[model samples]
Target: MSTNTLYGIFDDEEVLLASVKEIRANNIEIEEVFSPFAIHGLDKALGLKETRMAIMAFIYGCLGLSLGALMIYNIMIVDWPQNIGGKPNFTFYHNMPAFVPILFECTVLFAAHLMSITYLIRCGLFPGGTSDSPDERTTDDKFLMVINVDGDSSPVKEMLTKTGATEINEKEA
Candidate 1:
């Protein structure tokens, strides 16, 4: 499918931020925004919901903790019971304190690694993925706001110009 899109490039981050708010306030649909760095409150201005990554990370952490606990229980209690240094390893509850460090490390490790992988996959930021940006200047000093236009694009263009866009371009995608 092909669509007409208008890209407004702003030189300043503040201008881009204000433009995003104004464009959203006017009820115009914005396809996406590209910038060198994240802008504060941009998600709020774009009316985006809270991300679910943290929740997924917590689930991964719990899974890791459970796995660590199970491994420790099996190795210390079920597989080959040990009584090192007069410390009883017959029950999980009795020896759980010694495994606390391992449990915490595993939880953090799983959460960090899995969440990073999930974020990369979700954002399509793999090693060999093509860039989705319309303009390469957005990777450095410029900010680009993309708007899908149907029928008429003059209104959107005028709005962007009024909002202090440094340059504006359109293309069929």
Candidate 2:
């Protein structure tokens, strides 16, 4: 990864996308793109497909909801019976509104707690973790494009220059 070269930097996403388009039009290899914030249509512009993260989240949420329902029902009805205020201990429908709070709370609790874990696992992100990031300055003020030179440095540089890059540099990787 250290051998990766930085072709240029742009202050705007439009400029970056245009440059990417031109490079791809000429069949050049783009190793990766670095951005501080997400740019609209950027993945599509780069010909990348959507991630399955949301699908995973939905599945995990459903699992949480099922687990919560099972636990609540089993505790309230099967595990132990506690009668209070002359209310039926086993029948939940008599106090629908009160039980609603428990059910709703369970749904939210399951969704939030499990979805976070799912997101972390799916994205490979962990708490207080550090890894390869583009640059501190790039995150705030610039977009960086990395490409493989493939031993044709002159033409590759010329091609990138044509895309209106503000700066260009050749990197080892």
Candidate 3:
């Protein structure tokens, strides 16, 4: 099936945000929006659900902490049992104070690296990824709102124009 996509380019973030609200109020479904910089409340305006990245980060951090604790326990108590600075290494609990830095570092490392990978994968922004932007101007100073219309794009175009769109373009796919 063929579909028509309408691109409404806006000169300002405020205009784009207002346009999004207006279009959504009119029961028009927006495919996506592109902007040069982050616009506050844009996600809410787009009606996007809250992201679960923080939850994932917490899980990754817990995994890292567990691994760090296990590694310390195995190395200090089970395998080598080294006595450093006259501190007892007989039990994992006794040596936990010394391993606090390692555990903290491991948690941060896992959370940061895993979160970065997850974000890249979720955004489809791996190395050598192609851009999905409809217009190059969106990467500069313009904000572009994309709407997929099955037929009769005139109403959408008219709405875009009424919402203060600087430019409007239509594409078929």
Candidate 4:
């Protein structure tokens, strides 16, 4: 059996939401909704869970901080330490200002670079990867609804027609 999903594209969020309501009134199942930007109340309307990207970022920031601190501490204290202009080699409680720059730089470097890499990986975005979205216009002013019906799409399309949907298409996996 062929396993595929169908999508209905709309030009505006208002029309999409209205159509979603119409589809739900007809008791149809929607797999997902895609938009270029956040549509207010969309999460509640579609019953979606909160994103964990922020949490991942926070964890990544902490990792950066730790890595930076450890690298600096080791190099300044244990590895190839040398006195500079009569200053102390390493002083955690005394000459902290000197080490602050490297510490801060490392933290920012890891967070900005590694966190972004992690985000891309987590989202399945890689260089030259094929696009997951069907319509190229989805990145523009279009909103898409991917529907997964139970039995047949006859009634679903009939209900979607009343929702102001502009176009419909199918995708296979």
Candidate 5:
């Protein structure tokens, strides 16, 4: 199925932000916005919900900590039961101080690596993936706001123009 989409190109981030608020205020649904760099408060203005990356990271870190502790306990206490420098290794709890470095390293490693992979997958940025951006200039110095037009696009076009869009383009997708 083919759909009509309108692209509003803005030269300034402030203008784009204001335009998004104005367009949403008028009950126009915006599809997406592309910008050269991150704009603070743009997510809130675009009505996006808060991200849960921090929560995911915490979960991942806990998984790593548990695995690290298990590995250390099995190796130092259960398996070999090593006694080095007069330090007690018969119980995992007794040798936990020496295992702190390994536990910390594992937690950091797992959280960082898993979070990176999660971010890439969430963003559809797998290897050999094509860019979803409508305009290449949006990666440079331009900000593009995309709107899906259902019926008449004239009203949306007029609204874009009124909201200080430098240029407007349309495409069928």
Candidate 6:
């Protein structure tokens, strides 16, 4: 199905945020918003759902901890036992103290790396990916708001112009 979109480019993030709130209040469906930097409270203004990246990070950390514990147990207790510093490696429990540092480090490493990967994938920003931004200025200083125009776009365009949009454009998708 063909879709028409109205794009409002603002010079400042504050103006974009206020425009988003006003547009949503007018029941206009916003396709997306593009900004050079994170605008504080813009997510709430856009009514976006809370992110679950933290929960995923926690799960990845747990997996890393388990893997680290298993590796340590297999190396020290099952495969080739070591008796470093006169401490016995008969079981994981006996050699647990020595592995604590590795466990913590692995957990943090997995959480950070995996979360970064997940964020990239979620944002469709992998290697050799093309940008989907409608305006190049959005990558520098301008803020852009995209509104889907299901019906007439004059009211939406008028509202955007009234909301301090520096430039407004219409396109079909």
* Candidate 3: clashing residue pairs, number: 0
Question: Comparing 4 and 6 by lDDT, which wins?
Answer: 6
- Write the residue-wise lDDT of candidate 1 on 65-134 in tens digits: 9998998888999999978998978788988888999999999999999999999988889888899888
Among these predicted structures, which one has the highest lDDT? 5
Off by over 4 Å in 1: 1-3
lDDT of 5 by residue, 23-55 (tens): 999999999999999999999999999988888
Instruction: State every prediction's TM-score relative to the real structure.
Output: 0.95, 0.81, 0.96, 0.80, 0.96, 0.95
- Which prediction has more favorable TM-score, 1 or 2? 1
- The lDDT, on a scale of 0 to 1, for candidate 5 is 0.92
Whole-model lDDT values for every prediction: 0.91, 0.74, 0.91, 0.77, 0.92, 0.90
Write candidate 2's Cα lDDT for 1-173 as tens digits: 13446557777888888888888888877878888789888787788888876676667667766776677667776788688686676764563455666666776776777777877876689977775655566778888888876555777777767787778877675
Which regions of candidate 3 deviate over 4 angstroms? none
Tens digit of per-residue lDDT, candidate 4, span 1-173: 55567789999999998787767666677788889988887777776788777777677778877887777667777786778787777655455678778777776777778778877997789879888787888889899999875456666776666778888886665
Scanning candidate 1 in windows of ten residues, the lowest lDDT window is 1-10
What tens-digit string does per-residue lDDT give for candidate 6 at 1-173? Answer: 55689889999887888889988998888989999999999998889998999999999999999998988888889999977888867878877887899999999999999999999999889789998999999999999999888767788899999999989999977
- Model 2 residue 42 CA deviation (Å) reads 0.2
Candidate 2 residue-wise lDDT at 166: 78
- Cα RMSD (angstroms) for every candidate in the order listed: 1.6, 3.0, 1.2, 2.9, 1.4, 1.4
Question: In model 4, which runs have C-alpha deviations exceeding 4 angstroms?
Answer: 1-4, 21-27, 170-173
In model 5, state the lDDT of residue 95: 75
